[model samples]
Target: MAPAIRVEIEKKHIDEAIERARTGVSKEESYYYGDRLTSGLQLRVQGRQAFWALKYYNFTKTIGYAYPAEDKHLPSVSAARKLAAACKDILDDDPKMLEPMLVKYYGGADRDVKKAKKEMVAVSTGWTVEETAEAMIAARTKPDTDDPIKKSTVAQFRLTLRRPQVKALSKKPIADVTKADLDAVKREMEKSPEGASMIKKFVSDIRSILTWGATHATDMTSLDPSNIWWELVKSGKKKRAITRSPIVDDIVKTLILAESYLERPLPGRFSEGKFGVGHNVLNALWWLALSAQRTTAGTRLRLVDFFPDPKRLGSGWYLAFWAEGETKNGKAFVLPVPPRAAGFLQERMAKAKRNGDSQWCFPSSQARGKIEIDIPVDRNSPGGVTERMAVRDYPTKDKIAKELAKNAKWESPYVDLLAENDIMYWSPHDVRRTIVEVLEEHGIPGGASAVLAHEVRLTDDLLFVDNARNREQYLELRVSRVTKLAYGAGGFIPLKSKAMEVWTNTLIDRYEELHSTYRQARKKAQAERVLKAIYSDANSAAEAKEAAYLELPKIRRKLEDNLTGHKQMLSGLLKKTPPPDAGVRTARIEIELAQADLDAFNTDPASYAIEPSRRAASRTHSAVLQSALKTDEKPVDLVVEAPAYTQLRDQFIADKIDVHTFRLLITERYPITLDMMDDRIITGMVTGDEAL
Candidate 1:
């Protein structure tokens, strides 16, 4: 018996090994004929026979047993070498080539050859961009379920990524898809610049699909379309507009008008009368704004997710809603619901209690028919989300915005009624921007990111254990006071004092003022038309007086109705002894002015018919100060003591109040701007004009 040895295969070595095998000198061991171009090809010798075999990576089994010296069918050493070299070339140049050769030489009985042949076919034909993408999609398995991918994601991919324009690229072999192919797809999509985002997402989805297929299917080539987006970006061909936040006044007016529209069914749609769907939309918008959670989180919000008991964590009735892993980031977290957002949820809960459907916090009408499944059968079971019910559950953020746009008449009355306004419509996500902007205006640093739950680059101080302890202490000691200011609990303003009321009143005032112009114009026009009819007929004076009597009250009543309705709303909001600085004073004054104009018009409709003269003096302010020392124009005489200023400085540092608010408070007795107060005033620094 001889010890098995691994040696480089040469003609000399093969001949010596064959001679030893025939004489039974090394019959117990096999001789490996190693090929530099290929792996696992060997000449096994046992007794007086030798077999050509392979134990390569793909073909992990030995095949073809023949005695080269005795059998007429077996090839000579030179022929065997040539055959091995051909197999090596087949493996390199064409994997499919090995399939037919394996079937011919090794036969179908060879397991490794059968497996390798199957894989070779998949790699050759099934690795086209389209086929590989499909394969990757099919192979995906989600946790705790048999769903390959989310239905919504599948629909999105089909709509955006699998467009007809990409069909040609999809047909190309995955490896053969060049930058040119991707650029062509980009150009095709770029024709509709609105879909610039879709093209970017298409590139990402394709890259992800191909990468997954390459690793998992063992049949696809590496495909990365990331460069396509970069190329488009570098070329400055990509066109995506930045969406601005909706003005806060527009948001409030939209909600109010939407509520009005809800009172009556939509002009053409909304068959179910007063289903509170308008309130649902308004509530959803408010929730998105105040909570700063994405629409998906708001839609899937459940009644069970709320922790109403104020006893826990001293949160004082905060909604500790839990978002699932299905969020934008695959992370589950508990979001602290602000008071305004919680108010919306509480309203929904109250409605649910009245009507026994309390499963979803913000359920759609379709949810009424949905019954919860105690036991799950599949992804489409009763417990699973349904497409029909997804408008409010797993809803698109733009759903509310689109609905508002579709019902534009709901907001049209408030759209351009004020100061040459153009605030027509806005998306629900704009609410997030609105909140962030308002907080920014109030000088709350990093509050926007904190509210939105966006990831921020943490500094060493933020990560320090001592800083963590300080945060814990603040939360524990000042949670109630801070929550009032930040969350607007118990009539506390989340913004500047009476900001929401001022905006609401301004919207109402503008609408009423516009109505007043239309009313006076219509009345005058109607009177002229009536007088013309009388004059053409050559009627008596009694006829003209009769027409006036018939028309004037109706016009007056319409204008008065608007003013009366607004007055009622304002009167409710107005405190009996409102603080002089309170915004309610302005709303009260507006109502009084509107009421006075209405009464004066009723007394003399003919005189009121004339349009008022425009005052050029009021249009622009004069650069020179008035020579008269008017009491209203006089600077405030009150002086802030050093101790009070020092206290204000400490309060600003403690975050008890913002710098702007502190300035407003100190200058409340005076007609002073926030700009006039300056940081120096807050820090008690002596100005050249002031004594410290």
Candidate 2:
């Protein structure tokens, strides 16, 4: 081989160099002449062939051919020097980018240059963006780094790639991803859901995968470095606000509505050990509202992650929790659980324990199938969740209010209730933001960063300015050692506790007000108005009183018809098994209310009546409707917990309106007997216009 030599890389010098390479070079690879204009630039010649080369960071790369006789597409002397100078600057920052640059601009037209890399996967036959992204995901599965990408981050990465514009472009290999294609993808993502605020983060994630691929040539050898990714990697960071700050009162009301939904009996179908994850969903929603943590923090939280802090502050023993090794900043989160929240924590602990789910604080409530064989037999056996909440049995807020309504087909109260609270829409993440904002307002400026599990000193350099790094002088501008020590576990507790207490108390006050409103509304309900006239009014028309009393049984019969089909279906289920625990509790209430409705029908309108509790009377409407839909298989000897309205029945029964045996006869779950009805009342019912 000819020896390397220095020369001005002009067209004249390049021509003279190739002629000498033909005579002096032996049967070897090549000979080179160095450039004075560019640091790593060289003109390499091998007999009849000559090309521009660069040796950046010790690795020699063929820039392109310089021999006109060999190839007409040769770059000019000045153009080759310009390309070399630009590439050398990029290499100074990241030397790993050299292989990708060659794959992109080899021969001045992105084709293989076997002189630099051992092999290359060209854009035409190589892995698409999707395929390379998958490779990146796999490599990160057990990544060997202090800070690794999270599974959720990978999930978002895949979702961004699936967007229409991005997905279409991803079908092409990374090397073929042009600037036009990337710009179009950027616009599409910016207009997407959560776009304006999250677009930068999404684009950065894509660039990360490309960087991973470019560095690891054995896995992915080819990609167009000229694509817009390099420009975007260090681009401007101006995050736009997408979600508005949550209205603090609306947050409180949302919690109130969620509690109200949970308090009601589960709708009939969901009540039984119906195969579902409903209870977990409802409980999870409440927990999320109270805690104000990320959805995953609450959803994936295990009972084990929360150990009570031994340092009990006042009467409350606060819990210190971390995000199960998945905090966004990779820092441990230590927030104080206020007194109200601690009470809620205890309540949830008791509930989870009752269901035999000690592991997950929010466990799946899925029940084994109570549904039986199609052959003629009772399909349902005694029903309840057979599996306890355990490891990885996380919670979600889907279908939260579906099982709360008496009528399952009706639109879930969850949606309408949120609307009533004047929250057209809000998410768990919105709640998280509101909590953070509250902390910021109450605490010192930038003091709330610790609540979000961020390192205050690292993320927010309070004492330092941006230009301070460019003009360094002093040892440091930071705070004292005592201040740093104070910023640890003990310092944050007071700030966290105050924020939590204010929010929790606000929510509790709102909830109590809502209950007061409910009481006022129930007093004026239509059923309440009719009952007062039928039993209490002293000087009403006899015909109006008889007519009002007559309407009760008619409403019962209509609702009872609605229950028939469900009862028949339920009987078939019970022949083999029993109802689910929730279904059983609710069904028992329905049966008692239906029996009470029968007793009210059989009683004669008294000359002097005792006033009944309006609350119990109003509850009767839902109970009657619920009972009609219950199954017929009865447990004769078993005494289940009774409904609230049963007290109203007891009030009338104690009045001795009829004989004790007479009361027992009418209340039994048998076909309604007309034997006790007065002839005049019966005739009045036969024809409403006729006299009582």
TM-score of each candidate?
A: 0.28, 0.29
Per-residue lDDT tens digits of candidate 2, residues 1-692? Answer: 66777777677877775666556555585678788767888888776667787897677777667664454344578767766775676567656665555554554444333333444232255678888888888777764542257677889889878877676877877666655666666777666676654567656767776777676643463764444355554314476666756666665555444444443532322453443334455456555666676566566454544444445636765564543244555544555667777676567556642234224565544422221211111111001111111111112123333343444444432223444346434555666677667666665434344455433222332322224354333213222221332246455766666666766665555555566564355433323322222222111222223444445555557556645645554565456565566665565566566655545645643311222222233333333323322334231110121222233333443444343443343334212222323222111111111111
Best by TM-score: 2
Q: Which candidate is the best by lDDT?
A: 2
Tens digits of lDDT, candidate 1, 177-273:
6566777787887887555676777776776665565556554454443433333332234655767677666655554444454456433234435
lDDT of 1: 0.47
lDDT for each of the candidates? 0.47, 0.50
Q: lDDT, candidate 1, residue 149?
A: 73
**What TM-score should be assigned to candidate 1?**
0.28
Per-candidate Cα RMSD to the true structure, in Å, reads 30.3, 28.2
Q: How many clashing residue pairs, candidate 1?
A: 0
